[model samples]
Target: MDSIPSGEGLIARMIEGDESAFTSIYRQYHPALYTYLLRICKIPSLAEDLVHDVFLKVWEIRHRINPALPFTGYLYRIARNHAFKTLKKLAYDEVLQEKVLEHLQFQGNGPEQMVNEKEYNRLFQEALGRLTPQRLHVFRLCRQEGKSYDEAAAILGISRNAVKKHMVLSMRAIHNYIYRQGLVITLLYLAQKIF
Candidate 1:
């Protein structure tokens, strides 16, 4: 019967780039880490991916692992950080997809409007580009992304009132920009309807 190495020995072996030591660590910790991530992320595939990412990071930073500290605690911290980052990216992707869909729908229901829609889209992009990065992010998160004020606030690390204020100001600026473009009243109506 073979005994598993102590945490200290395993850490040293991993720092030396021992594949078997890394495998041993993975086999010991992967299940618990997967379960913890699954509980936090609530998506099986995402949880599995995060667990894999955590282990990959651990392997990459193996030399930095401190054997004197609680290895399990360190592993969990890595898993937690990976899960949060993955979640944030997923949320951002979802929001971007929604914005694209909204833009498509706003274009029109018929092919006859294609040329006008293309020009309008160009101008709209320009308007968006004119916004300060922070205001643009806030607007996208709160308006185009359809996130609630609280959700935007939490994600942006700002107060709920601040999110509301940014949304108000952002919408006003976009409205004024479109109005100045002399596009049409329908464009203004569409903008108001969408945001």
Candidate 2:
């Protein structure tokens, strides 16, 4: 079995500019974070780039990280925020969006890819369905419709901070739902293979 390192210890060391601690954190979190970002961006190269970008940002702000708090959530928040910033830019840039679309279209996906896409879409929808009605509405407005937080707030007659809070909660809920579902699927596959 692989041993899990002490996150707080590693983080504390990283705060002291320990390269090995930072590398350990990167090794521990990279795969899952990359998968998560890939799902969000739908581009492998961009997701890989975003992963590096996130790690670099983490290293830059290591001193500010709270070693007492769970590092996974903090790391994920950074990754999510970075990915969303890139996506927000993509949403505003028609040329970039067209290029991304063209790139995706150029990639010839096989049947396996199709099945994976369907599974991902199903899990994503299920996660969305698990959100509260208000949270769901806020998510649709800001994420799906590409509305700004302020615009979403105006539409819902709520404060912008409330809209932002809803969006953050909704995203956390969605990520947790998908992660749970993924674990279940993985376990089921393992069981089938074993039995």
Candidate 3:
């Protein structure tokens, strides 16, 4: 389905308890939700589980859907809430957290294969953490999460110019750190060769 759906047909169909229609809704929106969950959580398995949970909640509450509102919005609202909850849960479990970190580790042809993704993830998180919440929010909303400046600004309740400013700072900080550590150069060189 197109990301911009046509009004509330989905909500109406879902509310009417049309099982196949609900399945269509799920199939149409699953990819976007999965991508959002994966980027935010940085763990594919957890992200997949959360995506399942999001759809399950939508199905479980089918009768409660309001036809006047778009079901896509409702679905994403559930996804976002569930993702945040999962993030918090992951923060509390050292073993599970380590597993997620280990799972994200990168491989290379030789010695580079040994790189610990945990260190990179930790550094990225630390750099992000050092920002004020507003700046970090701007950073994630614009860059990592790929929302447009206008969208991010609206979500942050700020002006587009401010969003640009914070994102500039955030990107500069990230790029500088990555470059100082040789990661940026390596990524850039590889990207130029690959694509």
The best candidate in terms of TM-score: 2
Give a tens-digit lDDT track for model 1, residues 1-195.
866596888878887899888999999898988888776654466678778889999999988988788899899888776665554454336553343234435654322243366766776787889989988999998778899999999999999999899888888887656534523333333333322
Q: Please write out the lDDT profile of model 3 over residues 1-195, one tens digit for every residue.
A: 744243477567667886767777878899998997776665678778888999889889888888787666777778877766555555455665554545544332221233357756666676787788888888878777999999997887889999999988888887545433334233233223322
Better of 1 and 2 by lDDT: 2
Candidate 2, lDDT over the whole model: 0.78
* Per-residue C-alpha lDDT of model 2 across residues 63-147, encoded as one tens digit per residue: 8999999998998889877876776566456664554555544775322233366787898999998899999999999999999
Best by lDDT: 2
lDDT of 1 at 69: 82
Name the regions of candidate 2 deviating beyond 4 angstroms.
Answer: 1-5, 92-95, 107-195
Error of 1 at 192 (Å): 31
**Which pairs clash in model 2?**
none
TM-score of 2: 0.50
Which of the predicted structures, 2 or 3, would earn the higher lDDT when compared with the native? 2
lDDT of 1: 0.71
Which should have the higher lDDT, number 1 or number 3? 1
Reference-based lDDT, residue 47, model 1: 70
RMSD of each: 18.6, 17.6, 19.8
Q: Summing lDDT over every window of 10 consecutive residues in candidate 2, give the lowest-scoring window.
A: 186-195
